[model samples]
Target: MEAEIITIGDELLIGQTVDTNSAYLGQKLGSIGISVSRKTAIRDNESAILQAIAESQSRCNILIITGGLGPTKDDITKKTLCKYFNCGMRRDLTVIDHLEKIFAERGRQLLETNLVQADLPETCITLQNNVGTAPGMWFDQNNKILISLPGVPVEVYHLIEESILPKLQETLQLPIVEHRTLVTLQKAESLLSKDLEEFENTLPKSLSLAYLPNFNMVKLRLSQKANVASDLIIDEYFDKLIATIHDDVFCLGDKDPATHLSEHLIREGITFTTAESCTGGFIANRLMQTPGISSVFPGSIVCYSNDVKISELGVDPNIIETYGAVSEPCALAMANGVREKFNTQLSIATTGIAGPDGGTKEKPVGLVYIAVSTESQSICKKFRLFGNREQIIQRSSNAAIWMAKQVLTIPL
Candidate 1:
């Protein structure tokens, strides 16, 4: 099966609101073995909505429309849908009763505008909204399905789960769909794609690969939707794909870098700490983002100033005066100090000049020295990055985290 998503909103078109509904719907439809062919975001105009509906109906078996459903002047989706379906608007008593109960329980007064939300297209079946006043609409016409949902994400989720999904299961024939994602860092998209070209081309017809890149990492997702049992075949391809990119693979699954690091540390029974300068505890925060990390992560010290480096992290003042704060020696000293202070086997330290200023002939902006130290081994590397203040800090933080992971993988 194939589907298309039409997000109707002037706010979304003008960048005032983000249309997360399209992605959510597309993923949901995919899980039901319905592949989304296209996604369109249009303004809250009657002509635009009509055009989208006509265009999408011609090509897709299922068309999902969201937004423009509100008890306000600008909300005209229901009225437009009524016109398109050659029907009139009618008040739904079931919706009105649901809303009345909600308002009474909340101790709020209902206005005429609120009552207007009960109006829906006569030709479409009303799907009950459990959490909100606006009811979802489902129309099956000419062997095609069209579903209209409210713009609020939580309300949309509620209606989709409680009312829409069951009806879809009854109306459409779907196949089994599954997905597997692997996270890899320190590899560019171009390089990864080039390495996986042969592997992707050799995959079975039911499987597809997706490259989802982030600021410092890439997520390689493999999806399969078919009637035949392809689980073993899919796993085999996944193993091959990971083997092809073995050098760059960090962890297998949808978990982020922080979660993967936390699980790895927990499994290895290792404790860790952080000492930061320009990154200002960003690495520490990322490490602690995963739950149950408090037992392994002792603490972090942010020595942003030269005085703090000397007094807090116990960096030698003479070293800072001789080679500057953002130097390899300073970074090593910070890492060793934190690891010894916490008595942990692993520690990550960052010292960088992340700025649009504070550069010179010898030391330029975005000059960073990251150090990852263990009880037996410690290493430090200097980087010359190029970005503004925030980007520099972020890059430095990512580098430090990656360095720590790389250290653990090394065979001492």
Candidate 2:
């Protein structure tokens, strides 16, 4: 089954808000053999919403809409849906009771607008929202399933997880769709593809290979529908492909780098820290984003200047004088110092000239030194990258993280 996602809000068009709902819905729908054909974002205008619904209803079996379902004046999706279905509004007693209980629990006075949330389209089934007050609506109109969910990401997640997904699974006959992804780092896309030319050629006609590149990693995704192909055949091909390119693979799966690193660190039971210079805590931020990282991660020292490096991270003044702050010595020193200071099992460091300016012939812009230190040994690498200041910082941060992963994950 194919579907269309419509995200309604003026904020999304003006860049004030990002339409993350579309991605979430698309992924969820796709997992149930419902692929997203197109995504449209529009202003919260009645005529536009009607037009969008009319245009989309005939094209796909399932249609998802997020946003503009609130108690405020700007929220008009409920009314719009009623008009499109040529129905009237009816207040749901269950929803009103839920709202009253919620208000009382919070010790807040309920407004008329809050009660208005219980008013849904007359002919649709209501999907209760456990996370928020706004309930979701599921309309089986004219042979198509149209689901209208709340704009808030958390509420949307709850409605889908607790209500909509199971309902869809029970009601619709869905095919088995599988996607297998693995990540490889350090190698450029061109080099990696050339190396995997034979493996790609050997892939079965039922399995399609897609290359998704990010900051410093290439993700290889293999997709196949079960009806068109056998699972055993897909597995055989996937194993062969992984075995062929296992030399370049870091972590197998579609997890973010931070998540992959966290799993490894947790499994290895190694404590880690970082000392950042040009990236200014970008690597640290990424690491901290993982839950339960505090057990493995100590902290980060962001020394953007030679003085801070000397004062905080204990970088040798002579090393800076002899080889400059963006040198391998400085990078190694920072890693070693942070490791010793935190008494960690591992540490990563980055020292780079992320510059639109302040570069010499000896050291041009985008010159970076990365170091990953363990209790017993340390490894350092120098890199010459290209991009603007933000990109340089991002690339440097990603490289530093990968270096840490490579060092800490050595065969035992």
Candidate 3:
């Protein structure tokens, strides 16, 4: 089945709020064998909303409308929906009770405007919103399904997962669509594709591969929609793809580098820390984003200056004077020092000149040194990366994390 998304909001058009709901819906709907044909972002105007709904109804079987469902007068989605369906509004007692309970639990007053949120279009079925006040509306007309959900991302996500998906499955017969993604690092997308050229040629017509690249990482997603033989075909091809480029593969699913590193560290009971210079603690911040990382990551030291490196991370001042702060020696010293100071089993360090300025013939910009230290061994690598300041910093951070992971995980 094909679908179209209509995201209604003034904030989205003015760049005050990004239209992330469309992307989320498109991905989720695609996973259930529904393709998103188009996404339209419009202002919270009644005429525009009606026009978009009417235009989209002619194009697809499913229409997802999000936004303008709130307590304020500006939120006119329910009333506009009623006009479109030629029906009146009715107060749903169950929704009102749910809103009252939510307001009471939070010790907030239930104003008249808030209570009006329970009034939905009479012709549509109400989809319960466990996380928010505005419930979702599901309308089936002319053999098409139209679902209106609140603009709040969390509420939209909840309704989609709990109500919308199951309802769609129950109402329509969907094909089996599955995906297997491999996230690889330190390899450019073009090079990875060249390596997989023969493998791609051998794939069946039912399967397709897509490469998604960001910074220094690439995600290879294999999607298939077929019968019982699809699973075996995907499994066999996935194994072959991994075997073809095993050295570059960091993870088997669509997980970021930080998440993969954190899970590995926690599962192996490895305590970790970092000493960052040019990357400015980006690696540490990424790892910390993963929940339960506290058990494995003690802390990180952002030794951006020579003095901080010497005083906090205990990087030897002599090494900095002899080889400069962006040298391999300094990077290795920082890693070992942080490991000793924080009492961690593993440590990562980065030192680089990520800039549009600060380049010399001897030492240029984008020159980075990354080091990973363990109780048994210490390794350092120097790289002449190329990019703008932000991109250079991001690449350096990814390299440091990949280095640490490689040191910690030696593939048998």
Candidate 4:
């Protein structure tokens, strides 16, 4: 079924609050074979909400509205929806009781505004909100399903999973949707697209490929919407894509490169650590995000300064003085030193000039050197990236992770 999401808030337009609800809703709806045709963010005004609802009803079968459902003056979504449906407000006793219990549990007084939150459109069915005071509304108008939800992320998540999805399944005949994502690095998006041109051309109408690129990595997602042989067909295409670029593929799923590396380190009982310079513990931070990584990854050294690089990671003072801190030799030494210091089987090191300043003609900004080391051998690569300081640091960290994966797969 076709769907559209309307995220209502002035904060989203002003960039004070990001509209993450649409992404979450789109993904959830897509998983149930519902395609999100369009997503729109509008100000928290009655006219805007009415216009958005009118436009969405013309285009889609399912319309989802999020935000502006709070117990305050600017909270107009519930009233707007009532006006659109030409219905008067009705105070739901059950919701009032729910609110009272919530307030009592929290040891807070229920104000008049909090009680007014229980009021709903007379024509719509109220969807219970277990996590919050605001209740979701479901309106079936002329066969088009309109669902209005609260703006809070956690509450929205629970409502969708616990109530909305189940209701959708009960009402609609949803096709089985299957998606396979392959994470890859070292290739630009244009180049990867050219390489996969033939594979994409051969894909059936039911199957679609989307390239989601971030930093230096690309996520190749293959989706299929059908009931019969969907998984088998998707897997067949997935294997073909992997075979075409097996070396670049990090893992055959949505998880990041750090996650796969951590899993491998844990499975093979290999220890790891990082010696970070310009990346400023970014490499270590990404690895630490993976759960239980502490078992294999003991710790890391973030030597941002020359003194710390010399003292903590034991890089030679002469190496920094001669070839400079951002050079390949310094990266290699840092990698080797960290591997030895942590007493680990593997280690990653990054050093670079991620800057808007402090760059020479010889060593420009985004000049990064990444090194991966084992007890027997050390490998370092030079990268001349282009971006702001944060972007350069992020790309450098991704490069380090990719290099670590490559080093672990190869024998010393």
Better of 2 and 3 by TM-score: 3
lDDT of 3 by residue, 197-269 (tens): 9999999998899999988989999988864543547777888888999989988888887788887788788
Give TM-scores for every candidate, taking all chains together and pairing residue i with residue i.
Answer: 0.88, 0.94, 0.95, 0.95
- Give the higher-lDDT candidate: 2 or 4: 4
Residue 1 C-alpha lDDT in model 4: 82
* Cand. 4 TM to true fold: 0.95
Superposed by TM-score, candidate 3 places the C-alpha of residue 107 at a distance from the truth, in angstroms, of 1.1
Ranking 1 against 3 by TM-score, winner = 3
- Each model's C-alpha lDDT? 0.86, 0.87, 0.90, 0.90
What are the clashing pairs of model 4?
A: none
Better of 1 and 2 by lDDT: 2
lDDT of 2 by residue, 335-376 (tens): 999999999998989988899998889999999999999988
Per-residue lDDT tens digits for candidate 1, residues 1-412, read: 8889999899998899988887788777777788899999999899999999999999987898999999998999999999899999889999999999999999999889899999999999999998888899999999989999999999988887788877888887778788888987767899999999899889888889999987667899998776766443677788888889888887888876776787778767799999988888888888788777887887889888888888877888899898888899999999998899889999999988887888887888988899999999999998877678888887777667678777787321
Model 2: lDDT equals 0.87
In model 2, the runs with Cα more than 4 Å from the true position are: 228-232, 410-412
lDDT at 281 for candidate 1?
87
- Residue pairs with clashing backbones, model 2: none
